[model samples]
Target: MTKPKTQEPVITSTSELPTSEAKWVTLRKVNYTDQTGAARTWEVASRKTRAKSAGVDAVAMGNVILHPARAPATVVVIQYRPPLDAYTVEWPAGLIDEGESAEDAAVREFKEEIGYDCEVTSVSPVQAADPGMSDANMKLVMVEVKLGEEDGEELPVQRLEDGEHIQRVVVPLTELYQRLVEWSEGERKIVAAKLFHFAAGMEFARKEGKKYGL
Candidate 1:
């Protein structure tokens, strides 16, 4: 009797990876008065991805794609995060370029990061990412993609930036929760809050036999 081979896990532990010393973020202090008229100074960090015309933190966009034609799956990316000294599992996301809309940013980032051209279905309102710490805001965009039914499908070409190490992972929607659980138990951890909530919601909807319109 022959044994069947199992597929390797999509997530990988990269805690030992080294990061570049290039300065990608900057910190500054701002003094503001509160409702009680007390003046206080707060430190804030800013990313170089922000556009010059932006007053607040630059607009960022994230995509949640569902492929209905092929094997049911969602697009995700695993990339090294220097701050945590670990690789993070997150959706394809990027900062909106000058003269670009949030929807366009999401579409462009999806292709650049995951190498798939997706059709934007919906865009959410601006949501804060740690208002108490950073002024960064993101608009979650939903897109629908189709991956053909084939064993070992051809991987798409990525257009990553210099110093970026992103690995595209096509996660089956049916096994998202299980994968998350496995990650939690394994060495690598899922630190993206949006990704966690999205997976949880999807699993809940699946259990309740409910269709997520988004």
Candidate 2:
């Protein structure tokens, strides 16, 4: 089969966004008190699409797809992130629709972005996404996808929405950290903070475990 061609998106122009016209995000001048009771003000960018029923803004799926004949692997998404004007290596994630639970969002996003049906194994507590910059918070939902021998190694076709151009890469869990590092350097792609941290943490634990004979 032939592969489809893709081009890097071009930027036509840029301008400051007016707060009144902003739909997805907004700028805020926050006021607060420090540890010493000192008054302070800081500029911050905030998301305007957080659903009140969801509580948290989004969910990043920590996917583990197990094949009967092969080692367990995870799928990561490579998509163009306009803010950086470059592609990013990130977990399959998406905003929780109104009244949608984190688990449902994770499952839906995984199917849409990676074309896999997964079962939610666990869900993390609400955690900050970028505390220093935005008030965005998210949950890390651990999901497992079981593949039968008949399924083969090929991933299913993605069901992405319009305007979405994402590439999915499946990597063994043991090689995930190294792969992310190589992709970041070789492809000159930005690594999303949450994804990078998760990979780094796994690598760190593996190294410590070996050193401690764990």
Candidate 3:
């Protein structure tokens, strides 16, 4: 038996928009000052919102930082997130900061957060982590390398660059997992970052077992 052929999606042109050529009409230029104020509002413009069907929200560039441990019990790590009030425990991550590639940022975060220099071997596609929020986006990457010491001495403390606050610290994979389970603290831990820890830990455990000629 033969089945009917399906039709392909057709592309649309700008002529389909509310207006032929998109343009912003300045409704008013607003600038002012209030009591005890020297300067005030800057110019603003308003534009029609995109159709509800077309509006989409997302979060950008997120990764689970993984630091593989070699023959040691140290869950050693550093962290330097700011305000210290909201208590956000997450892997070194951000909104896919402009001008920086995801792979580049992932490498930089490893250095800044855990002081590890790793290269991105692969990356997952961008996806939303938050449905209720616009720009609730993130991506995961496979950062590869053999772990080593920082400054040839102590484990490097986690630090953030450009005052983009964060703290880095190594923790025992077991301990961290315990905390996550016991306290139900999801905010402090990025979903992707925790996964990275598990992956690295499992790999490390396997390697160590092989080292003992297991």
Candidate 4:
């Protein structure tokens, strides 16, 4: 692949783009089907190619579930995706299926990965992670739940704790900032959604506290 050019902004109004944004090229392996009602699977490579320079050509959804804590705290599940060794901490995120809304996908990922249902409160403007090399960007949305019972839904965790790795743990405001810094430094990566989710949940918890005089 040739060197990717820079400064091709589809549209911008958020934080500084990650260095990786300029270096994520992937291919679309379309599974042709005869049935119109059929489904297909899409896969991305761990490395970039010359063709990926145009854009990332992919999209995904993510969620950060806020649970009840002593203080206004939030939950962050630690999981490790393939291609990136070492169990890096992250939120419940996954690729948007063939036809899935970002918000809806977020909910599905939450349920399957975290085993819960949630409602989206706010969505961040769409942003790119690696822009120059790959057009791949992400639609980040935040969500919450004051109190809800687990529906006891059973979903396949094909990616966590079996062949995959995932660990769910809650983090308070006291430690959030530090982790964000740690993620930024770690080579694996610290997605913006994780940080944004923490901010959004803490905001809601604060408001809830003010109302109850906590």
Relative to the true structure, how large is the alpha-carbon lDDT of every model? 0.68, 0.91, 0.46, 0.53
Cα error, residue 46 of model 4, in Å, equals 9.6
The candidate with the higher lDDT, 3 or 4, is 4
Total backbone collisions, model 3: 25
Ranking by lDDT: 2, 1, 4, 3
- Models ranked on TM-score: 2, 1, 4, 3
Task: Indicate whether candidate 1 or candidate 2 has the larger lDDT.
Answer: 2
RMSD of 3: 21.1
- Off by more than 4 A, model 3: 1-84, 148-153, 157-159, 162-165, 182-214
Highest TM-score model number: 2
Task: Give lDDT tens digits, candidate 4, residues 104-146.
Answer: 7677777666665677887666676555443456666676744
Model 4, residue 8: displacement in angstroms? Answer: 40
TM-score of each: 0.72, 0.93, 0.45, 0.51
lDDT of 3 by residue, 1-214 (tens): 5934543223343233333354732233456786888767554433333223323221122233343443322222323333232334454554344455667667776666566666677777765553332334456666654554432425565565553544344445445555534433544433344444554566567668788764
- Best candidate (score: lDDT): 2
Which 10-residue window of candidate 4 scores lowest in summed lDDT? 50-59
> Model 2, 65-122: lDDT tens per residue?
8988898899999988888888999999999999899999999999999998899999
Question: Candidate 4, TM-score vs. the true structure?
Answer: 0.51
Q: Which should have the higher TM-score, number 3 or number 4?
A: 4
